[model samples]
Target: MFGEYSFNNSQPASAGGHPGPGAGPAPGNLPPQSPGFVGRERELAHLGHLLPDRRLITLTGVGGVGKTRLALRAAAASGPERPDGVWWVELSPLRDPGLLTATVAHTVGLADHSARSLDEELCAWMADKKLLLVLDTCEHLIAACRHLVGELLQSAPDLTVLTTSREPLGSPGEQLVEVRPLPFEGPDSDALALFRRRAVAASPPAAAAFDDPGRATIAAEVCRRLDGIPLALELAGARLRSWTLEQMAQRLGARFDVLADSDDALLPRHRTMRTAIGWSHELCEPVERLLWARLSVFTGDFDVAAARAVCAGGPLPASRVERVLAGLVAKSVVRRTEERGAGIRYRMLDTIREYGHDWLTELGEVRTVADRHAHWYLALAQAADRGWMGPGQVDWYRRMTAEHPQLRTALEQLLKCEPAAAQEMAGALWFFWFACGHVHEGRGFLERSLRSGPRTGTGYTQALWALGLTALLQGDMDAARGLGEECTRSADRLADPERELRAAYLHAVAVMMPGDSVRALTLAGPRARAGHGGRSSGPGWLLCRLATGFALCDLERFEEAAEEARGLREACAELGERWLRAYADYILAMSALGLGHHGEAARHVRAMLSNKRLLGDRFGIALGLDLLAAAVAGLGDGELAARLLGTGHAWWRTVGRPQMGGSPALTALRDEGERRARAAIGDAAYETAFLGGTAAATG
Candidate 1:
């Protein structure tokens, strides 16, 4: 029997963990090395040789060929050579290319303070650094990654980029490295070694059985039939706890032979990987198989509770889902791992998910399962919205962040079959979208759901309001106004005061963008008062108050705005609501600045930035940065203020909108800050400092 070995031995303790003095800012958020990583010695050496000379190296292979694992190993092996340190950015969960730069910037710890674009910031940051960036799982965002890598490599002569994907990124200097499966032949092959290791670890009693020559040959045969793909072999090896080595081999042969007979266009190894998954699927108990099929609807990892809520029904009862899910995990059909503060989550590899999805389609349960998945997430969104202002605020934010991928999948599915359900789900997700800074993705979902068809009643009205709010935040004033008007008409038709209030809130925001502070305040006051009735604390009511506060700030009623914002901030704090609290702080900061309370203004601005960062709210962060720049300008730190302004500018570009739609008050503040900065630092020095700040923030 082969004993378990540690793969982390080849690198120093600080290699991927932390940075020493000379290593620039420890590798930014690299994926943890796999404990079971095995058999990529040649690939590691190949990458080491290629990466030093080539600017871009893409590891290309079919799914489950261990491209990501091999890439990580190669990166860790070469960690000591790069003084600026290596960075890893995983793109598996990203659905929109528009957010590509922002995602990478956030991953690399870029504060994005400049008014310039995220890409510019990235280029400026990388321009003079000696670094290695490993972009894992780039197949989905290949075009975006290609363009970004092209730009960065062009600007930063010393920067090296490595990517893992099913295909090449096709950049100008990209060297493609095809990652093949582990060798299956020969007695000392890596495939057999990996199988024996995993099999023994999975079932300690099976170690003695593998010591027999005949059983060892059976295990090798099992690995060969599974195409020697690391993922497939691991799944096969996990079954050793239940089946004898020979039985597992026989079962795999029978199932794979059928699959191999078809799909000749697919590479032999690709077919083998698929068949290996199908074999595992075939060996599952009926309930486990059903659960596997239903679980395919989820786009990311999910807990047992989510599994039960979305997958349990009819033949698969909620009471039995946990046991079946555990069985699936035991069989290696589902990967189980713990998320900090989020507990254990189960996920299927994309290949396994595709196989299960096909089975789900064949079973004629796609619609049923999709609807169930949508309904489950819809309920979750409602719960999150309800709890957005209470003790569970942080938990709600975490849950929404973790479940965002699934929520998007649900919205996509719902838009096709049930537009009303889609509308409701999108509308319900308003708090998560706005508070968490998922503005781009949320807008996409809202637009798609709205385009699916006309909807009626509360769901449609709320969807209109939500869409209007998103547009307003993104600085699409015309669209916001149109949507707001539509929402108002719908609210009137339905005669719903809550809907009316929400509609007015959005409308007032659109109205305020052009600098009509008094009208905006008047427009929102009555509706907000009506909605609150002195006791309402839902997301809608909070939003209404937020609009009123904004209007007051814009009216230059400094004392009045501070009073309103302070009350709202305190209320939000009591309820543990960070989103509305952030807005309240923003208003308070502006009010403090208006009152020449520079220290208080700085305090409020810092508070706003903290909350925005916590929620991953880049748009809010940009706003906070701008306000902080104003505070610094008031404090006589001209150079720092100029840099902060540039940083804020960079983030604003990422938001895809103008700040406050070029309102008079905001423009004046920006102009005044620049004037003071230039006077204090001189124009040439100010420009240099500003550009540097932009680079640092975006970089």
Candidate 2:
């Protein structure tokens, strides 16, 4: 309210008896202030002509390039031409991806009773209507914009979508009109005219005030530096009231560095790019502010439940995080995106979020808030792990995976600690290492957790198992053996069978010395059975079994190993999750290859590769690449196999997974593949050592 501008907050005039907000013929009153649209003549005409042919017109341009102003002009010009109304859908305040369609629906005043699809209701409302839909700031919601525009085009051909974005909306019938900067040449260039107009508006006697031709030249330079982008030019002009043109130019870089400047008294967002965001922040209610600040903790988009858990500190009730989220949407500070889902995910623009981050830092809440955010997300990851290993596993995994960016942010926050947030934050997400294919992150987190202090009970077991698995997966026999021993010994003292079983399987996986496979299998078998029987469906169950089977394959028990892997695959499918299924597939593929089932091995390996890629598993990529190379080699395409092997080895070394330590099966296959590929592509010893040796430990 403090930053509120002097605009009529009431109804506006129209040809259809629509009451004007003030004593003016224009819809919002204060006259059209037409300025005859300085230089958008061609763009306007192009949009005008296209309006008759296409329903969706997306105007794309760089920030400050007058996209919003041009869109407003278009909406104003096309208003009377529309039958139902020319409605502007301001998406700046929307942050929840899940509520994107709902935001549109609410803006258009369309009601969907019976809980029917909002799209269906909105489309139905528009079907028989002729309206101009001006959707502003749609870059963050491009997918949802495309979907909505497409639906509206199909259902209501007469309903038009005039959108402003940083990029094209990529819809079937979207007519992309790229808005370039206003011209900088000639007295009548849109750039010069915009600069002058904005200068006059800010300083009424600016012409008389700056009698020197140098002031005018400097003004032009300011406009030119900003590329004649209207918003930027206007913002630059506003500085004329306080600072000399030279001072403004001298301090320009600060726009990016020092988010807000107290000297500027413009709109909140106009104070600086940072303060414009702060202005938007100021518009939010207290609860929304909390959500916004906490949301700033995320590196990228996040789901609603993540918001509820992390941002909704005790002050803001859980029941109202969604409603508070809605308020942020209206202010255009947070945008709702549909790339995620109706689960109501939200994100801030990068520049805007940086401002929020600065504010969060200023509040001195960065550490505590970050810890809470990390803890909540860790709990979320663990919860997803439970769902991933249980009934309806695929759906649960999807929910978790969809919110991964938030989870990643949480992990990063946990890397730095506040004691209040560290323990739960570190322990809760152990399963995510395997669940999401973030083996490196998992390993790093577990090692960090273990090093921090002595954690006990379930949390300690989780960290130990996670640390051991990470080492095992990286082919770090030494670390795996040591950690596995510590874990099993600790579990023995704690009398937790699950923990002991996990430790035994991990130790077997470590396989420090020769003939360790038999011992590993012996240790892993009974616990794997007990794990398979229990409600605990995490890595301990099938991951251990897979490790044991790999050990069996190492021991030359091909038939039994293949059978064991087959059972793991079935168990994984029953779990119905992505990353785990992928792991199971990798194990079976290895087993098949050991049994000389080349074709089956190829199929399984390909499946695993696809799944790992989908899961964004950087660590898994190394193993998948190696397996894929083996399958290609089996196909008798030695040249192709060599090429793949080179790529695989290079990638494996880059990820710093330990050399298979001394496993004859894994090492021999890798060496053979590398030797074959090197014969074709010359020796590059550096490639072998690219990321080898203690990379995981260092990380």
Candidate 3:
């Protein structure tokens, strides 16, 4: 039942520096742009006309004025029109001016920047390439960006640069596209169009309401208040899911007065967005601002409990979190999002959230804020870990996986400030290593977190166990054995049953790294059946059994492996383990594939993928994709095989797993499997279908 997992590490050409005109966008390239490109047909055509001659074209607009989305849409639509490729460069996290050029170069896969000035090398490289470079969100680094774009234009006349900012570059040969707010006329206007789109997203039936006088008026008002900016309108409309029209009007009135700053010097409506957001924030109570500051800790949408844990304190009671959240939503300070089967959640726009973060920091509460951020994430990691190991493991992972970006951001900030806390964070995320198929990420963080602090307490014990499990997953026998032994010794001294259970599971799994299927089965079999109480039986012990069973199947011990999987399933079901069932199904799928039961294998693989996908488990979903691809290939369905493989490749890229680094044995097995499939289908046909399928998948 041991199906191997892999990820795609291919970055975009602009990011990974892969040289080939026909070479596709780098892996994990830009996510699919929203199909919400409205009223930009004229702008897009204008930009296209200028693209042939001008090497640098920039779209300048106020924040929330749809710069990034427009640029992204233009790039994707124009990618095929360009010869080299369309490369989008998002330059927001780059702070140091000196590292600006290096950041660009590193993204394009340039190694050893110390050997040459990155600017010079970048210019030289672009001179020969006919690609379109879309530099997004550049307002924060305007001067450095202006200089770089100017030099690149001078040197690489054939290359095209598309930039988005709050202001123009004001450079020679620059075709400045001054993006204005959508025109808020009747329903047909751009502003109204954007509002209708957002309203439709909130309530699909609202699409028909566009023709209604009252709804259209409100939509127009919303568009006008938001200054026809798509992001702000979307934020406004999202609140409509719960808010009434009258409430919206009242809030907008307060927002406009505050945002407009009636007595201040007159400014462009777009610039007033910041003021509008400030007004919205001011409408929030001290607790709302506090919650806003804490929400800034997340890089993506977050849950209510997370907000409560991180943002609550100082005059604010955690029990009143729901009310504060309601206030923020009422004022449109926090945007709510829905998760299937999970309740509604909230987030702040990057720009607005950053403003609140700045305010929080200025209040001399950064350390306190940082502490809350760490503490909340520690709780998050623990919950995710527990979810992964419990029933509905797949579903739990899906819910937890949705929070991956936010969790990572929290942990990163924590590691930066209190490196010692990283130990707990890493340990807490240990189940993620095997369950989500994120062995590499799990290993990297575990190693870094452990090295950051001395080996002691639960944190140290957890780290040791995590390290061993990661090694075992990657088939690093020696490292796994050593770490496993170390983990067991540490746990023994600690005398913690939970820790001991985890360490023993790792030890059992490590036995398989040395190709000892019998020993691994002997060591992990009984433990695999042992109940983990609230923890899903799918963590170390179950994963070890699955892997060992796969090894046993390869060694011709099919009956033993199958029996073990069946036995484990029964135990898991008795414990109400829904998540463990998915893993068991995956193991059975692998065994069926090995046994040449193609149809059965495909069914099991599909089940596993569906289960994991529902739970937001990207890692497991990727593995399921890989298994499905192989299963289809084994079934002689070349077309289906190619499609599954392409999807698997995309998911792998998103996960950022590298080949030939860990688990050489599993990697080789996959390579051999791919080779065998290719030999069966013929190389030419497989390549054609694979490439075509990959192209379709990316689109």
Q: Best lDDT goes to which candidate?
A: 1
All models: lDDT? Answer: 0.76, 0.60, 0.65
Question: Model 2: what TM-score?
Answer: 0.55
Over the stretch 1-699, how does candidate 1's per-residue lDDT look in tens digits?
Answer: 000100111112221122111122244446578788888888888887898899899999989999988988888877777766778877776666877876666455443433345688778767877888888888888899999999999999999999999988888868999999999997778998888888887898888777888778888788777778988898888889898887887877787766656756877878778767877887789999999998988876888888998888889889999999999989888989876646778898878887899989999999988888888888888777667778776667667766767787777778888887888889888876665555555677888877785767888787788777767766678888889888889988987767777777888888887777677777677455674353456555666677788788777788988887887888888887787798899999999998899989988988887776555566676677777877887888887887887777765654544365576777777787788778787999888877866655433
Winning model by TM-score: 1
Ranking of all candidate structures by their lDDT, best first: 1, 3, 2
lDDT of 2 by residue, 194-313 (tens): 777766666666765345676767666666556565655655665555556677666664443465444555543234343334434554567767777767877667667767776766
* Backbone clash total, candidate 3: 20
Per-prediction TM-score:
0.84, 0.55, 0.65
Clashes of 2: 21
Candidate 3 similarity to native, TM-score = 0.65
- In model 1, what lDDT does residue 571 have? 81
Q: Can you write out model 3's per-residue Cα lDDT over 12-88, one digit (the tens) per residue?
A: 22212222111334321343566667888788888767777777888987778888877887777666666556666
Model 3 lDDT, residue 484, Cα: 78
TM-score for candidate 1, residues paired by index:
0.84
Candidate 1 lDDT score at position 521: 75
Worst 10 residues of 1 by lDDT: 1-10
Indicate the residue-level lDDT of 477 in model 1.
82
